[model samples]
Target: MDEIIRQRIRNSKTLLGPFPNFFYEKTPDYPQALFLEWFQVAVESSVHEPHSMTISTIDQHGSPDSRVLILKDIDNEGWYFASSSQSAKGKQIEINSKVALNFYWSEIGRQVRIRGNAVTMNKERSSKDFLERGKIAKAIALLEKQSLILQDPHELEEALTKQLIKLNRNPKLISPSWTLYKVEATEVEFWQADKERKHIRLQYNLRGEKWVKNLLWP
Candidate 1:
């Protein structure tokens, strides 16, 4: 390694990092409360696309795969995300529903980790979600083959254009495999960076019908 590059790596731990600009007690007793609070602050901050997140899944052969996606919605129902059931992530969920979700707001130097099992939303809800999507999104979803290598460079663009026409003919058309899946978080962790490296780590664990808060070593 170059000497200067090595020196830069050595200073990383103490170089860049936050107490957060939002209202947070030194220690939080409520996990969800803290999460929502942080989320709100992140949204209000200068972070671009604060709702963007990375979701990780394990394939059938037990290989890990992850991709960046927008967080569709979140509520008592859980974190909402949509994908084609035949897609790699969806197929992996079909075999093993456990998954991990990560949210990072670099502008605010905050991150959240959620782990839980993914469940497909009911057909009624799923269809409603599909129809509620914007026309272009619906068109893309209509092309159900996600993550597949295209034989022709223009294949997707051509297909999307064709799909748009069919959609225009029948506005109610919906894709069969476009599903909304929810991740019911079993455990959640919130991490906040600190200038002095005394980072804050708070975790919430679900225990038999209740959530328990705990502190973590940074």
Candidate 2:
């Protein structure tokens, strides 16, 4: 059985791309601009969850943890995402602000990796972000006990019901722990896969308010 599974894994094909000719493409001076261009392509290509990305954080014990999250916004400041301050990832961010974000669009055979420091936005911005969420999402945020052991499933249902009721009464009620975080990227790498085993990797490094771009060996 193990041999069969191993063979299946070994035979799996990857990096098959009718990929863009990024090798000859002119890249922007800023990583953000290039990222937006690639993101627009992904959206037009109908890539599933194009805004979804993996955010990796370092825990208190110095172990790396990662989870998929939807991208909230992006600007010159950096990439934005939201979460509860009391959640595991939030606590980890408090301990160590450094983080990495990865976005993969398999259909396009492209990926973007970012290493940066995450900082909490001001309370006004955070509250605005919270209010923009759907009622169900707002209710879940109000629960505020994320990553805690749920000994009783019924308790969650009851808690969610209560929060929904509260929302109905006061629509403006927002979770105090809900926070918006922005990642200020120091390094960003863009990778494009080729069918012929030659992949293109371009990296941008932040250097004293300037961005330096270089090609990397695949």
- Candidate with top TM-score is 2
lDDT for 12 (candidate 2): 95
Q: Which pairs clash inside model 1?
A: 18-193, 18-194
Write down the TM-score of every candidate: 0.88, 0.96
Worst 10 residues of 1 by lDDT: 14-23
TM-score of 1: 0.88
Give the RMSD in angstroms, all C-alphas superposed, for model 1. Answer: 3.0
RMSD of each: 3.0, 1.4
TM-score of 2: 0.96
Per-residue CA lDDT of model 1 for 28-82, tens digit only, reads 5556567677878887776788788899999988999999987878876478898
Candidate of highest lDDT: 2
Q: Which ten residues in a row have the lowest lDDT in candidate 2?
A: 16-25
lDDT of 2 by residue, 1-218 (tens): 99999999999988777776685258898898899999999998899999999999999999999999999999988999999989999999999999999999999999999999999999999999999999999999999898889999999999999999999999999899999999999999999998987788999999999999988999
lDDT score of residue 8 within candidate 2: 100
